[model samples]
Target chain A: MNNMEKIQELRHFLARYDLPQDRPPLTLGHPQADAVLGGGLRPGVLHEVFAGNWSAGGFAVALAILAAGTKPLFWVRPDYEAMEYGAVSPNGLLELGGDPRRLIVVRTRNAADALSASADILGCPHAGAVLLEIGGMPKCLNLVAGRRLAFAANESGVTVVMLREGAQAEPSAALTRWQVSSAPSRADDDDWGNPVFDAALVRHRAGGLGHFLMQWNPEHAVFTTHPGAVVAAPAHRPAYPQERRAV
Target chain B: MPRLPTDRLIRRNGAPSKAPLVVSGKSGNALHVHALEARAARLGLYKGQPLANARAMVQPLAIVPADEKADAALLEAIADWCDRFTPLVSLDAPDGLFLDITGAAHLFGGEAAMLAHVTGLIAKQGFAVRGAIAGTSLAAHALARFAPAIVPAGGEAAAIAPLPITALECDDKTLRALRHAGLKTVGMVAERLHSELSERLGKSFVTRLRVMLGAEEQPLTPRRALPDLMAERHFAEPVVTQDAIAAALLGLAQALSEILEREGRGARLLEAVFFRADGKVERIAIKTGEPLRDPKIIMRLLNQKLDALADPLDPGFGFDLVRLEALLAEETRPATISFDHDENARRQIGFLVDRLSVRFGYTRVQRFVPQDTHIPEAASAAVPAQDRDFGPETWTLKRCPDDPPRRPLRLLQKPENIEAGFPLAPDGPPKFFRWRQCQHDVARAEGPERVAMEWWRNPGLTRDYFRVETKAGQRFWIYRDGLHVQDQLAPRWYLQGVFA
Candidate 1:
């Protein structure tokens, strides 16, 4: 009957239609390391990767992640020199199907801003995956502000990967943490041969410590086990009765 | 009494009231009508006498000065106070205010109540006030100044009937014409036919008269409409420190986030308003790189921006109210978490880089993106620090014709000139070279890679680049500028960039 009444009626009608739901998280598989993850990477969760001495292994893993799909990936490299290690040698990543359009690389100035931004990207629903390079060893990142990112990722379903350069004593809230090291190459004549890598799944929420030797095939852009590659000794191997010593 | 520009008329008790004469005297020539309560009062200096004649009547009459600016400022304050009732309030020149309280009346419990409330408030503030409700601002203004202080709805005509012809607020010339036409009371002129009156007085007379009679509607322009989303916090105890302001900011940001999340949208721009105890408002704003609804992230960004303000947060007395508003918003999809360990790690790293870049300069942090161009320098661009692209795989290692035979380890920001002579062919490196106050002999040489500048651009310069290795095993990327024609000057050599 009146303008107010009309507006009220319209508002009630609009209230009935629900808002559009968010897009499902995008899945990505390391072409050379499918078996390493069982399937492909899940859309939403925090994953940690430890790089020991060999920086090239970390580069290869980063390349593998980028080449996995067309989804846009954000790469945040805090250390300037470390970025050169990945971009200078074009062997592993250049050969993979890494699209520049889908990648964003950022160099942060300080640790605090870097950490905060890492959390922000995890909270963003539209981001396919965010790659952050933490120069030092892993620290307690589960502060009040830090936990917001985990909650955001869980709520919005965006995957976040924290790459810590050195070793740490304590564990983080990451769903999975894997230590990656470079293994000897197995190729004889091919210029673009497969590079074998030792990936130790130190911690996993799914309950098992999955330590397996994987080979990264540059040509196939996938990860598989090499026949002759040696796997590291299991962490939980029971100490032999003779080897056990009293503290 | 004679009219004086600098004097005001006040009752003996300083109270405003309706009277026949209340003019104040200004100049010595001003005619003061009367005086009371003194020896000058015994001199028959009545209040209505002309000032000049009053001087002649009594030389000792007390005279008080008037301040026009003070009066104007006082009127403006009253207008500002009127804003509480309706945002559409404007000055009506000299001494009146026009407020459009149409739809706003309901908020104050109807027109009569709102009018009574405003009048009561002004009266309590020690000011004489009058107000009227009419269809048009001009009509209400005329009614308030000339007719009674209150007019019932639909009584505009009857209320205006008894008022003098001056109630029209016409110019002196028009009033004189109306007086000459024997039209004294507004009711007499209104009683005549509209066309007849217009023919007698002028077209404007009929128009103003019609507006006064509710025949036309006048629109009111408001200052600003209420924002789409608003969050406010009032402190129990006023806050005067930056820390307190920041804490308030956090609360506002959190509240705003909830509202934004419910709508499944994010704000691109946000503004925080700090309302001080003394009624002054301080505002701070921030623009996000992307639409975001996360309260903590927004608070961080806003904190950075606030820290950049030149004025220190001196709340003076203190800030009693803080309001946060999302000025611009966009629809956003929900974010997802990563399950893969490596992927999740990468996401976290990306976030870290973005935050660092915001604090530092984006240019300081960058990603190397391979370009499709054939020129060596054009092969890649340094992308700003953030999540962008790793670049196309096809162009990552594609060798360009303009690439040096042996790329230098580093590329200087700009080329430095060098003097050298080539012992080999034009495409070969120099046998001897001098650059940066140093001279070296080339034991080995590499072929030159010609790179032509973009001719379409202004001041384009072409150069033939070469990678030369000296006897000491030092590699340098050198270029010869200009063409090597027979008559042209010898090519100028300069170093640009190096390769590892």
Candidate 2:
């Protein structure tokens, strides 16, 4: 068989052994990004967002997705993340359109504990969305853990966002994976303009990869698109060359 | 009962039948006897004597290591058993138990009969017990340990006169000083002038003497709260099965519910105390989220608690008395429910939370309550789920629909320090910030929402917070501590929380 045929056969085998990914999609409110994703972001399935250079952009996107639903959000974070980076600023998120009152924060000691809590939160139907934030992809979050999260999210129909910091795009059971970075906000009379996000669809199960420049309009509580803008390369880049990542 | 360290371990394995048993603790270079069994006492081997010397005096002696925890647990169990006689049972540890029979004694015929019944019950369990009844706990304690088996009413002073002054439960130093002062017995100590005794032994010695002489009655502080209402059932034959216990609990709960209904009250906390025939006692307590009067719910909760115990309630031969008491109760009136299903669902959630908390511990199951505070970490407090009704007032973040909120959905427990590069002005948001070794250039910056320290609660540096979005879309709530006021310390920046 040709390479394409062999790959198709592998996908069929994986579909049977692994959890089902068919679920209603959640719109990210960006047309181009949604079109590339075949529909929109799928709910009841795990989705990973890598914080490329800037982690806040990825986290903002996660919150933006969560703000779509009115149910309570359970955010499980590694304790070290609070120590290393910073904790969630309730005031900032509130201003960003996510209700601080409906958020339940669960802090675990490590990435493994965070993942476990994420799986537990996904099983609760009352949790509108479950966000698990970790510094990097720990070894414990293997294929098995990913499948378990997918299964739980599917059963409870809760959107699960796995926010990873300084993490490369890796293959997993996640319905789609994206890389997000902060973009220059569109200028206005006000000093600090609308929050713009440079988001790229790095991986998708159904296969179309695309990028979109998104801006958060707090007045309407929705994302407005900026026509075709990618994140500018960092001025002072890392000493080591960036390694090619697997989709 | 204050046991010499050694007595605890030996008591658990049952009393040493033949050999003289002595509990020993290490003293200086050799093992010293801390407590002596009756046989050892009879053999003239007293407590605090070295083991080598004790062994030299007695040929065959049984020894065990000291265990205070096991002794305390045993004391608690025995106290539970005594609850069958009177709800007022408190620990007189390391070896004694105080049972305030008072008005309860008449139910068992009289005080003498009640004492005999208790002694008989303990004796049946293979334990040697010396019990006494008096108007006060102090008199009863002294009489039980140092004087006769029973002190007659209004004859407490005369009855305890012959007992040695050492029966005052004083330290060895005081005992030695009392002996040196030629006060050999209770009678001798009582004869001395109060001023003279207080001058030499301090005021406590005079107070102790007064309490023991029945001059100043000492009240008994019951270990468990005196139940608001109680109902108990005595079996003609001891019950050894779990089913029997459940039936007894249900019966008691129903009877207690009737009494509670008359007063328009419901039980918040209920305890089922089981007194075993073998003198062992097992207690199961249930706490409800709201006041409850339903006998069915009470019985179900008790059963759940009993089943959830790691060390299952052992009938230990058999239980003869099952007493159910409402340790805590609250006023209640029938509420008219708009929808029965909603009320039922709410009750079901409460019951599920209570059961889970009881099984896995309350700390593991928690709920958050918002507080009025600007210090991000102090905005919300997590409390045990069961304590949700501890206060009547509920707090939510106050924000107008049209106005933007200043708090994030999730706040970090502790603010983290980060390195950043900013303008020389030292007042505005940073142009670039480095957090967790990742640098982010400013793409968007918002105002410095200054949150002054709660000086009334805690004095702290005034913080100027800025909502800054890094070049990569990462939003951070960074704050510069201290103000730009002249003569103020240089303000340091900290990453308080994230926007997402």
Against the true structure, whose DockQ is highest?
A: 2
TM-scores of chain B, in order:
0.54, 0.72
Every model's Cα RMSD, please?
Answer: 16.2, 8.4
- Interface RMSD after interface superposition, each candidate: 9.8, 4.9
Whole-model Cα lDDT of every candidate shown, in order: 0.58, 0.70
Candidate 2: interface RMSD in Å? Answer: 4.9
Docking class of 2: incorrect
Interface RMSD of candidate 1, in Å, is 9.8
DockQ score, prediction 1: 0.07
Q: What are the per-model DockQ values?
A: 0.07, 0.19
Q: Best by TM-score, which number?
A: 2
Q: Report the CAPRI category for model 1.
A: incorrect
Predicted complex 2: DockQ: 0.19
lDDT of 2 at A127: 58
